[model samples]
Each structure stands twice: as structure tokens, then as C-alpha cells.
Target: MLHAYVLYGVAGLMLVVRGIETEQRDSRGGASWNEVITDIGNERWTDYYIRCLHPDVIRPLIRGDLPKRLQDPEFRQRVSASLNLHATPGVYLCQFHQTGHLQPGDSQETADTLEQRRGAGLTLRQWLMVVDDCRLYSDVNNPASRNLAEQIDSAYRTTRATNYASNQRRWQSGTRQQNFAGLEEFLNMMDRRWLNWARAQLGTPNEWILDVPMVRAPAVVGQSKNVTERASHHLALSGSSYVHSLISCIVKFRFAYRFDRSVWQLARVERPDHMNLCEAIFSILASAYTWELGLNQTVSGASHQAGSHALTASALNQIYQQNRDENLRLGNVDKSLMLDEQLVQRIKEIKAFDKIKDQKFAELDEREKRVVEKGRKMDTAFEALMAREMSGLIRLQHRQALEASRAAPA
Candidate 1:
């Protein structure tokens, strides 16, 4: 599982780097794209965003025996303290279609946006407490959660403010971010004698690996291998995979929010930011709950655009070229027909062949036209869908802001 996770991260990092390189080559100011491309290539900042957005590793952390273990008060307190200590400072809400603000420019929309922005951002500790402890989406009229929300909010504001200032000073003093080669670094550290001794003192992995089958594949005789091979081949398609990986990172992390770098820098604490590695992972994973809800349409639209631009979907251009080659091959076959016939019969046969070929060519042309038209219609529908989803997200944000206000202490 660790191996698969690292491989996926590496593959994603490669795509991100390649995509930036591609963008630079094609665009006018490609040369100007430097540090960000390099950082992403090296698995630095981009890894943080990618992990936060997808949280694929969260599956094991939540479902494993850990949650049951967390039910113990002492264990929960330790976990909570670790989370607060290492938690990345600041609230990272979805930007929602890169608008930063909603349409119609209404006063209500403005107020909702301001309300969300004005709060002292939640640290991971505060975020989890508010999200899990208060059960923000549920607990309608529940006084316990409401009171906890107020208490957590008060505590979080104070905690985040103090940390943010310290982080800002650290950033100003040119403190370098620790080179985190993701989870694999821990294994490397463990190999050293002193680190091995430290680990023996620290203890070993405790989380239970459940044997439950998440995806079941019933035994199939002959066809299974062939199908699996075909699927692997499709996954190997370079242009499509790179385009997909890049677009996913962009739409999920990049387009969802546009952070002011200066403001965001203040939120950075020295590494190791959170206490328990697994808990920190889970927190980042769970952080995407709201963003995923709102950005569904935007994701679809971006995927469609990648498919169209990269020729990743149907390879429509390749199909067109293939059709042209087929036409040429047919024409060549027709010329061979003339050699096999007598003079008078050959003339008649050539005319007959010409009519048949023209009919076949006409049919092929019609099919290509239909395919192109279908793609166009799909693109149009995708745009409309995105617009509707964005509007809905705006309303949802407004409603959430209102609900939060009502729940706040008077």
C-alpha cells in the first residue's frame, strides 16, 4: 500500500512537471514559468495541495481500527493535541469557480463572502473540532453542538492568531521548509542506527489493516486477462494521462481557490507541522468535504476541455486521418481492378466500382460529421452545466454562512 501510494505520487508529480513544460512551450510567456514548475517537479508545495484535495489515503485511516481506538478519551485527547500542534494554520475554503466572489453582485452575496473571509482561519485542530465535534451539517437545534461550536470558535481564533504571527516571523527570517520526500522519508530515517533506536523508543505502527475487500472481482476464466490488458493499455496513453493528472490537480486544487501568496505564507508553520502523521493525513483528506460538493461541475468541464484539447478522449483527429488513409487504400485497390479486366468490360467495371466507392466514401464522411457534431453538443452542454453548478454553489455558500451565523453565540 505504501509502495502504491508513493508510485502514484511520483506519477502525479511527473505529469504536473510535464504539463507545465508543455504549457510553457506553447504559450508566449512560457519562459517566465520557473519556480512553481520546479517546486511542483520536486514534490514540494504541490504535494501538500494534492494530498489535501484527494485524501485517497484517508480511507485506511478512518475505516481502520483507529477510529474505535479514538473513542477512548485519553487516546482522543492525545490525538487532538497532536493534531492541534502540527495542524496547518488557516482556513482553506473553495474559491468556487475562481470567482472569489459570486455573480449578480448582490449585497447578500457580498456579505456572505465577507463573513467567510473575515473569520480568523481555523487551524486543523479547530477545523476538525468544528466539523466533527459540532457536526456542522447536522445537529439542527442541538444545544451541545451549538455551544461546542461557540467554544471551539473562540479557542480557535486565539490559537490561530498567535501561530500565524509566529509563522510570519519565521517566514521573514528565511527559515527553509524541511525537505519532505513524502511518507517514504520515514522509512529512510528508520534505516539509520540512531533513528532505529529512536523508533524503538517511539514504538511501531499500531493501526489495524482490515482484510475487508473494498473492490470485489469475481473469478473469470479467459476473458479477464484480455480485459485487464486492454485497460492497462488505455491507462498508458501518454497524452491523455498527463492531461488528466494535470487537469485534476488544477481543477481540484488550483481553480478551487486563488490564495494570495503573501497571506498564505503567513499560515505556514515549521515542519513537522502536525503530530501524528496518519491523523494529519486524515485531516487533510477530510478538508475537501465542502469543496468536492461544490466543484463537481467545474471538474466535469475541465475534464471535457482536456479531452478536446489533448485529443485524449476519442482521438477524433486520428480517426479522421485513418479515414483518409482508408480512402487512399480503396483508391489503390480500384486501380488494381482495371488490370484484371478486358477493355470494354474494364470501362464498365471501373464506372461501377467508382459508384460503389463514392457511396462508401459518402457514408464514412457522414459518420465523421456526426461524431464531430456530437462532440460539439457535448461541449455546449458541459458549459451550461458548469454555469448552473456555479450558481448553485453560490447559494449553498450563502446558506451555510447564514446557518453558521445563527448558530454563533449571541
Candidate 2:
């Protein structure tokens, strides 16, 4: 009776697992194994292999003897679901509300219940159970399982090759810097192409900027004349939206450069080096962007305040009189102090940054000089060693010749 009950229990478990897989197929539209793995991400996968996966499961999966119960299709589906849980554990619950995880007209009560369930991320044992199942279910014909196993090996190799400490040592000795030359060249080409595209759009006749001035100058602010035409033009131009799209393009290019496998593989070992020239350039660009943003905000606020009152002739006369009175009162004020404080502060910050950058450049130059001097000393020693060895060899040859001559019959 106990054996029969055990059989029934196993069958029930299989049924539950199979049903879950069916639901996943319906929800995911039968996504391929590769797609699922990609959704997990190479970095996460690497982390799983290196730091998370159980050693017991690893050996069985490696040896092709993983338990069958662990290999059920439900475990595979859960792998991707686990990633969703890892990233957004439905902590807010409202996050899952729009995700259709809750049915139509479902109250916050229902969402809270769902969040409770979703918040429970995959634990280590559960992940190991999946691995064990895959190992047992995996065969030479099980391409999905086999592919995952292969990825584990690939991740291991990548992680080992890109070890931070080893890469740093190599970099300090100036070993792996040449590896990035090709990648740098490719990025430079990409930059030039993007620059040309941006120049075409923003320069010579100035497309978007011109559109703004052209429409706004002709239209009277208070009147509804050409209202429809002006509105349409404004909508079409998107009001400087195109001007900011360069930011997105720049961001996309940066991510593309970061994740390109070929380029990443080359420098994978060398963690992020703040002393890199590229780092300096990026910092400068970011500072400039921040300054522009502050300037724009200040101008925008001032313009809004100035434009708040209607500019009737009497209002303008009043404004002029007020400005004259203010100017007379502040006539002896230092021009520098009278300037926008934020602008002055930014200038001071920039000068400080320039000084720091110069210091760093000088330090780098001195370090290079020391490295060069060290190399020269090593070269001189090497030359002296070679000369001594050659002289000793010649002396031995001469002594052998004299001894042979003396031994010759006369």
C-alpha cells in the first residue's frame, strides 16, 4: 500500500510539473531555449555558474548523470521567471498589476496576494533542484540542456580569463594595453560617423533651431492668427526633442560598445581603470553637459519671471525705470560679483578640475619617464652581459687553437 501511494505521489508531482510547463509555453509563445538563456543574461549566468550553483549538481550535470525529477520542463520555465523575480520582486505590488498577472478588475487585495507569492525569489536549493533535473533528463539528444551545460563552461572560461587582479597586474606592467587598440580604432570610426550625422542635422542652415525661430518670429504671442499652422509646425518639430536625441544615440552607442563580445573579451580582464584617457574625456563631457543644463535652467526661470507680466508700453516704461534705479544703486558693485553666481561657481570648479587634470598628467608623465629609465638601465646591463659572454667564448677558442698548434707534428 505504501509503495502504491509513493507511485501515486510521484505521478502527481509529474503532472503538476507538466502543467506548469504547459502554462509557460502558452504565456511565452514557446520561446526557444536560447531565448530563455539570453533573458537570463550572460553575466547572471556566469554568476550562477561561478558562485551559486551547487557542487553536487554541477558534477552530475557535468558527468551526465543528473536526476530525472530535476530535469522536468517546469524547472526550465522557472529559470526565466526567477530572473523576473530577482529584478522586480513585486515589492510594490502595483508593478505586477499592469503586467496582467492579476485579472481584470482585480482589486489591490488580489495584487497584494500575488505580490506575496512573486516576492519569493528562487532559493539556492530550488535552483539546484532544477540543475539536478536537467542533468538527469539531459542526454546527447537534449539540445536545450546540452546548450546550457556548454554555456556554463563558456562562462567559466570567460570569468577566469577576465579576472580583475590578474588584468590589473598585466596593465601596470603595460602588457594588455595594445589589446584595446583595435577596439579604440573601431570606436573612433563610429564616433566620426556619428559626428558627421549630427553636424549634418545641426549645422549650416541649422534645421531644428531654425524651425523654432522661423515659426515663433512670425506669430504674434497674444493673437490666434495662424494658430493651427503654428501648432502643427510645433508638433512636427517636437520642440527641441530632436536636439536631445543625440543623448540617446550616445547612450546606445556606449552600451553597444560596452557589450560587444569581441571588444569585451579583449579587455575583460582589465576592470574599469579611472586613470584611462577615455575616462578623462567622458568626465569632461559630463561636466560640460551639467553646466549647460544649469545655464538652461537659470535662463528658463529668468525668462519665465520676465514674461509673467504683460509687456504693455507703460509696463516696459516702469521696468526700465526700475532697472535704472537698481543700476544706480549697484553702480559700484564688482562686475564679477554681479555676474550669475552659478556661472562663476562653475568657472571656478572648471579651473580646479583643469588644475587637477594637469597634475595627473604630470604624474603620469613622470611615471612614464621612470619606466623608460628602468628599461634603458636593463638594456645597458643586457648589452654588457652579452659582450662579456662573447669575449669569454673568443678567449676559449683562441686557447684551444694554440693548444692544437703546439700538438701538431713539426
* RMSD vs true structure, all candidates: 34.4, 34.0
Alpha-carbon local distance difference test for all models: 0.32, 0.30
What lDDT score goes with residue 269 in model 2? 13
Summed over model 2, clashes come to 5
Candidate that scores best on lDDT: 1
Q: Write the per-residue lDDT of candidate 2 for residues 21-51, one digit (tens) a residue.
A: 3555466563342232332232311221122
TM-score of every candidate: 0.17, 0.24
* Candidate 2 global Cα RMSD: 34.0
- Report model 1's TM-score to 2 decimal places: 0.17
Residue 175 Cα positional deviation in candidate 2, in Å, after optimal superposition = 52
Pairs that collide, model 2: 66-135, 66-136, 70-133, 71-133, 71-134
Residue 38 error, candidate 1, Å: 87
Candidate 1 residue runs with Cα over 4 Å from true position: 1-341
lDDT of 1: 0.32
Candidate 2: regions farther than 4 A off? 1-339, 408-410
